[model samples]
Target chain A: MGVTVLQIFPDSSRSGCLETEKLHKRIMHLDAVQCGMFTVDCDTCYTVTQTGNNRKLHIVHNSETPTTTYAILDTGTKQITLSADYLFDLLLPRLDFMYQSKKNLKIESKGAKYEIGDFVVKIGTVTMSGHYKAILVEVEYLPCHTPALCWSLMREFMQSFMGSCVKPTLPSYLQNRLHDIHTPQDTVQQYVEKFNEIREGTTFAGTQTTGSGS
Target chain B: MAMPVNVPHVGENLEAAMKSQIVPDQEFLLQGSVLDTSLGVVIDRLRGLCDNADILPETFHDHEVVFVLKDFSAMSTPGPASQGVMLRVRRAMDYPDLPYQLRYVGYPELGNYPALLRNCLDIPVSNNVCEFLTELGAKLDHEFIAKGFIMKKGRIKVTVFKMYKMGIGMAKDNLEQMTMSHMVELSVLTTKTDMSVAEDLRALADQLKPLVQLERIDYRRLGP
Candidate 1:
């Protein structure tokens, strides 16, 4: 519905709680109103080798858009995204012969949501198979649809609370879609990209391994 | 007599509840075709036999893309080989704003029934369905354009359309006809518990008797 930017808040202490609390305090200091909670979960299904070449399918569901299901198919070469009604969930089990769901690979991010003026901030704790993985912060600028037009203003707003972790430039996902009208699918795309990164045990962007933090 | 009367009422209530929650997935179908030259006469006949005979039949131009997902390893297996599931994506060419349709039709049930019954699911999907299906390893089998009239009589849908081959780069203009006949299909979607609708489909097909003999033509029986 708007331009959404997903940033990975680094967990230097290796415990996710402290970083999330610190971010929460900074956001609350900005007179932001706590607005319930949010969640975005993804289920990965891999194509059976007997069917063809191996591929990955990511089925994502966002609490904000409860009635919709976003399916991103990674064909090893390119990614194709399909947004369908929530009823699409029923069709997944029928595709078992072609794509086998990796039950243990299920990942989700859930945390408190905040509203400040036209911006909505969500700080989610990413967990894979119930194990703490990382921290993800999602900021959505409601008034603007094009990331190209709102990137600067959003960066300033994000920097107010997220500090240096907020990048000066657009996320790579938004770079190609800077001028395009942003949709809910774009938001989920960012989540899938970050989820995949966290799954691979990679370092978060804009964070140093200080090794000592409360 | 008293017990039978009470049982029907209870069964009807349960059936209604189940219908409210589950979509009808069984499609009872009958197919036949009329020659291109006789298409006008058949359309005129349908206009009278179908519902709302006063209004003109709704003409449609749809593009259908067929995708197949097959397990390559199944060819070597000894048991009944997998025929591979086929998914069809259909969108109206005249109405581009309408959502694309994703259709899954299973093999016809083998029985002594008067109509063809098969498991079917039709989901209105986003425009990105083609790309998603391809990414799911469903190979593009073929595509064609179907232009014709669609009429409805109660729950039964009657469609008489002619298929055309796509031009270069999937161009719509200057298309070539696939056959000399206009394929006529009479279908009704019903639930698994109800096989009674098959008779309705048969009755509708019988009306087009002389002009176009609609029958339960088993596609698999028609050799490749």
Candidate 2:
């Protein structure tokens, strides 16, 4: 509904919970009222066809919008997004022959939500296949819709708790859409981008652990 | 058929509950096309035969795109084994702000029915649907513009429209006619439990009679 910025909080302690707690404490210090909880999950399905370039379909669901399903199709060249009713979930299984879902690749971010003045903040723990992976922090400015108009205020608010992790410029996703009115799709796209990064990061880490063990 | 006396189990009742909640998806359709020279006479005849003859018929301009989803592995097979599933996306060019429609029409039911009956589902989807279909591996088969008038008589909807070829870059203005005929479609959407609507659809098609001979048309039989 408003401009949202997603930032990947560094987990130097190698513990997802410890980093989440630190961020939680810092936000509580700002007198932010603890709202309920929120979640954003992504499921990846890859093309099984032998011909043509490989493609990925990312189906995302946000707890805030319970009845809506957002599907982002990642072709090798461009990405396409479709927002449909929850019934779209029922249609996925019928396409199993062509697009097979990777059950182990399911990723989700779940955490406490907070409201401080006009700003709503959520600190989520990213987990893949039930294993903790990283931390994702989302800040939304409820009063403004365009990032160009409210990026400065959001940057300062994010800095109050997130510190140096908050960048001076907008995220690359928001930069391209700075002048346009932000929609819920924009928020979900950011989640997909962050989820892809976290997915690749886990694979990279998996290789390192196996190499050392061998 | 006798009614069961015992209470139905949860699994048995689940299907009944779903049926009660969802709207009808079966459509009884009859189609015909009139030549461009006789289009005015057909419109005049439809106005006289349909309900509310005094009011002006509702006009619409829509663009339709057909996409087909097929498994490449099945391409090797012969015969009609792998006809693939087709989904049609339609948007009203006149009403740009309205949501686009995604439609799936099943093969006609084989029975001695009065009209053609098939499964149909129309869902309103977001704007970026074309890209979504392509990503789903549904190749674009063809697209065309339909300019028409719609009239309703009870549950039956009669639509008479002319197809136009989409110009380069999908230009709305300056279009070329795909044919010298105006296609007329008479249809009614009903539930699986109700087959009575097919008779009514047949009656409407008969009313148009010699003006436009509407009949059950199996497009697949016509060949590509």
Candidate 3:
């Protein structure tokens, strides 16, 4: 019912022995879906944080779920994602704020997207404005949501493949918020940060040349 | 000589002291009104621009029955805090018309602009809604039928409707339409984090200039 996600990167390839027990190696296939995400705001605010009055709203629509709209409100330090069948009710008559964004970022993945015992691995690249931003490797332990409760177990699992990249620290957004209820918005906040970081005109050094899966 | 110590006591005075120091940020509400004389003409113009309109005339038939509840708790207050609460009832469109819809619509608080950031909460409509409101001492003030046309130009939703008062002992066919004007409201609900779309709204308003004056109207200033 819960999940613990770890972002990973590919470094050195293991030759023979490590590849034998790899679940993905035998199947070597996964049903991958291509996704494009765009973050929009009323031209006046940057991140939701700047929209200071009582509520800060952000709209992120993904191409994979073209019909579904995500409206996030950041109130105080708490972020509430509105769940409704009619999300357009909040988006339309764009009167109070004009929704605008520069471009949409695409995420394509490869490498071990299948489950390895209790963990599922996702190796993907995020691209925007025709440039690759960063390679994000996410490993999720399907059973737990609280990182503090299962950090050691997640670290032990990811350490098998990600090796030293498995830093045993939680994302800072979880600080003091570890005990709070976890929702999909926690994952959204992570993507929003990466989307914003790329939107701010920072290239991933020379990594811009890497293709979708490299 | 010992120095005199000034220690503040923690009670009503302390609470008031803390309240005075914390000021909430201002929200803005932008609104405009139009007379019935220009309703047809404005709607006609809106319909002409295909890229600007989705004029599903009947889909805008979002009929609402509004119930106003007074905060008698403020019976002692002579100020605006003594305002009544507004609740609405209607048939839930998504579900079979079995359950009625219930919601609380608060008046817009004073803010920086013509647009208001009012509080609205939706309560599930069930058999208990009536009993619950009754237990809270809510009274049925007046019920009206709001039939209107809603369209969107980009992100802004423009709602134009004429309110009709339910005639006493009236059948479904006997509702009386209020004759003053057709209320036209242009609004877009956004998170408080977004920037004001005043410039875009103003631009759209400019397109309909001279035909009708679309600007912010303070309902309070209009009087009860």
TM-scores of all models?
A: 0.82, 0.76, 0.40
RMSD of 3: 18.6
Question: What share of the reference contacts survives in each candidate?
Answer: 0.32, 0.30, 0.00
**Residue B84 in model 2: shift from native, Å?**
3.8
Candidates in descending lDDT order: 1, 2, 3
- Which lDDT tens digits does candidate 3 get at residues B57-167? 433433466654444444345543345455676653333445455655445666565455654434333433454344333477766676677677677666677777766
Write the residue-wise lDDT of candidate 1 on A96-148 in tens digits: 77777898899988888889999999999999999999999999999999999
Q: What's the true lDDT of residue B21 in model 2?
A: 49
Collision pairs in model 2: none
Number of the top-ranking candidate, with TM-score as the measure: 1
lDDT of 3 by residue, A4-88 (tens): 4635243234232243234333323333232222222111122211223343345444322333334554445555453322223
Candidate 1: tens digits of C-alpha lDDT, residues B39-95: 889999999999999999999999999998766555555422355668899999999
- Give model 3's DockQ, 2 decimals: 0.01
Q: What is the lDDT of residue B111 in candidate 3?
A: 55
For candidate 1 chain B, the 10 contiguous residues with the lowest summed lDDT are: B1-10
